[model samples]
Target: MSSGDGRAPGPLLLLLLLLALPRSAGRRRAVVNRSIPDVCATCHIHATCQQSGGKSVCICNYGFVGNGRTHCQDKDECQIGASKICGNHTLCHNTHGSFYCVCLDGYRASNNNKTFIPNDGTNCTDIDECEESGLCGHNARCVNTEGSYMCYCNDGYKLETGEHSFHQDENNVSCKEIGCGSPPEMKNGYIVGNYSVQPGSAVHYECREGFYSNEGKFSYCTENGTWEPATLSCKEIDCGKPWLIPHTTMTWDNSTTLWSRVYYHCKEGYYFNGDKNFSECTMDQSWENITYVCEEEELFSNLSIFNETCVRWQKKTGRLGVQEMYTFHVQGQRWYQKNFFHEMTFELFTHKQAPEVCLDLQPGTNYSINISMVALNFSLLVSMTTQITDPPFPEVEFVAVKGSAPLLRLRKAEDQNGPISLYQVIVLPLDLQSTFICDSFAATTFFSNTTDIKGYVAAEFQAKDVADNMSIALGDRHYYGKFYNAPLKLGQEYCVFLKIISEWNKVRTQSCVIWAQIKNLSPSLQYMTAVGLGSVAAVCLVLFLSFSVARSCLHRSVHPPPAAVACEAVHLSTTVDVASAGIASLFLETESVSLL
Candidate 1:
């Protein structure tokens, strides 16, 4: 009835038609849901699908279908595409109609034909094989490959990991060789080392035999190109001991070194030979080139005569016989035996010989000998002597006269040897023993004529020698006489005497008296008688002249004339009147006058 065609359709046909319509609708949906159209069409055909937007429309092959909209998606072969996945090293991939996966090198798939889902290619990073233990052998370093690791060796060592091979051969890891060079040696007292030492490195040492090092044993190389702390040392050389001989002295400058100076000196009374004072230690360790002298005291003899003589002379007459001469000798034998005078033991030499010896040894004319001595060594000692000689005596004489007193004359006395000696003339009264009169008699050779006896008061006189040895009294020389005309008061019985004396020896001699009686004389009286007569005559003549003058004056007074008398009276009256008038006039003018 709907289309009135074919007698009524069968049920099977009707059922087939119904199925075809739903199927076509579902195919359209699959194609629309697939994302890439060409990729989905790789395995599917006769599928009506359209791509609207960015999705594909298709029918899935076998066990695949579109999830929704237009894309075709996988259906599980085991679950999804698990049966078609690659091995353990690979990742599984699914397509619209089929699926497949491949493994990387050095890896294989597991026996089960299932897909492998890798954990993550980018998630887990590779491990460093070089750092891991046992990755390389001893003395070796490890390096990593794409999927594994290997080992290489370092210097001075061999790798014992893979095979038992020598380090120097190929395929073996080995280290290069290294070492420290050499040990140090010693020379002289110093230890020396030659080595390539690094900065801050150090070395140690000790001293050699037969020598002792004063410094200690260690040294170090520092950064400043010098050794630190110190250096090794050897002992110093030793020499033998030194000494000086007995009774000698020595001195050294320094004790530490073998070089030294030695000074030597000998004792008293001993002498030394060549370079006796100094020596030195030479390089051979021996004292060399020595120096030396002995002890002495020096002896002295002399003799001479000692004596002198002196003589004097008179000054006025130049007479020599009037003076005396004296001689004396000085003698000695040894220092203690020196004697100025020795009458018994000493032998006296002549004045001539004595003078010759003294003059030769005299110091000079100005110097004289005062002391003399003889040394035990026969040395003669002489000094000057000073002597004073006595002055000459005086001479005197007495002379007599008739009317005057006696006088004395002085002269020098003569000594037969030479000059005169000093003399004194002394007078003393006969009655008065204590009354001594003195007079100086000058010394001379000739007699003096002038005398000095004006007073004649002295009674006796004496002449004395210069040495006071002789007097006129002892000689009995006639030197005085009595005066015949002497005055009576001077005494008529007086006695007089004269004496000559030598003062040096106190000698005197007296002169004998010449006695005489003194006579008295009277003056004449004729001049007294003439003077008395002449005085009487003069008195008588004066009296006679006085009597005559008186008689003449009496005769004239008795014979005057009368007329002459009258005229005389008148003249007197007139003169009297005139005088009275003048007096009146003077008195009237002046009332009073005084006369003295």
Candidate 2:
């Protein structure tokens, strides 16, 4: 079947001959067989040649990146001249056709913070561990840095770690307040309100009773935690009672019996109601006080008369619808002690003043006769006030707690329909000394040391109803007495004292002490004792008659009539004789029975 020497058979030769023929059997193309020009040479330096779509085309090689045909340039994926082409905070490395992105210092990436690929949806951001407050240990504040955070301690506190800050894991940071100064102690005055006061609190300091404000007052706690002004002091507040003036008796003018004007005295010549003089003392005893005061005793008297009557004289009296001129004839020799300020004043009485109502005051020596004449109504009152002023009133400013005119708040002494209410406000001298302030006065050790604690401007409030002659002492607890209801003019100024006297009792609670504020003070003050006198005399007469009737009955019972006495004796004798006869007959019967 096979030809010798591997020759093809007729059928196989015909197939080979057909395969060797051109793809088109019809015709053959005339080829200009000049050597084919190198197509790659027409392209750019970085380009290469390729045959595609039955044509020899010049193209840029895949590994060699370029823009387009005709002229091709090598593309730099690494962007060596123009940065950020890869991405910020990343290192770029040129490759065959692309670049590699490597994260730089303090940078991160979406896939991997240290290593990143270009065009990835991730950014290199700072590692802000400070976003958490507890990043640092206690009492430390966190501060963010490039890729880390820091800690710092607060003011006024110390860290136990010894450093300013420490990490949370250390567990050693603890804040403690800084040390302060030592606690302070006060003198003389104890803490007025609270003793155990803390820092940032307040403390009030005051002196003892009868003592003036020597040093301590108001103070505060410092940041160092101690009282600032810690010293205080108090001095004695006493000058015992002034010695007795010859032929004069003195008494206290307050119900407290201790807090008010100490010695209101009357000379022997002046008439006084014995019943009203409740504080007449004749003995002396030691006193118990913050400052020593003399204890008073009852007036000792052995002298007595068979009978005596009092004409109870008043120092100042209301006008009986008349004008009286009273002259104070000071001895001319005493004028040497008087100065420009030694002037007496006659203050007019009236809440509602009329310009025409004034006082005629003539301040002169004994030779000239200091006469004060006043025209007042029977319902009106007159007061003789004198003062040896210092520094003068015009120079001083008047500071009323509220104002010069205060509204009176007292029960009506009499209803508006009835007699008018009468009130009295007595303002004593500011420098009222028990010391012998006059030249002619006897030299005595009575008021030796009464410098600081003079009666702290005591006041007596009294209300009277002239119609009923009934007086009431008012200043009870209900009445707010810190305010004065006296009629004070706006432009006028005078000496005043405000400290209260602290003594045996609270005078403010006394009804009589604050009466002026309770009732309106009238310009008129009429003392009407005659109205009650008749009633008192009637009561005494009734008791006298009652005693007389009892005495007559007692006399009758003590002495019996003579005839009754004789009859009683006769009856007693007859009864005795009858008893004796009966006894004798009984004895005889007994003897006869024995014989039988």
TM-score of each: 0.18, 0.26
lDDT of 1 by residue, 479-580 (tens): 332211223122122233332332322322222222222222121243334444444443444344335434544565655455644654565555555554
Model 1: how far residue 99 lies from native, Å = 16
Candidate 1 colliding pairs, count: 94
Once superposed on the true structure, which residue ranges of model 1 sit more than 4 Å away at CA?
1-180, 184-203, 207-216, 220-596
**Among all candidates shown, the one with the greatest lDDT:** 2
Clashes per candidate, residues 3 or more apart or on different chains:
94, 15
Q: What is the lDDT of residue 226 in candidate 2?
A: 50
Error of 1 at 166 (Å): 20
**Index of the highest-TM-score prediction:** 2
For candidate 1, the TM-score is 0.18
Cα misplacement distance, residue 474 of candidate 2 (Å): 32
Off by over 4 Å in 2: 1-37, 41-107, 119-138, 141-596
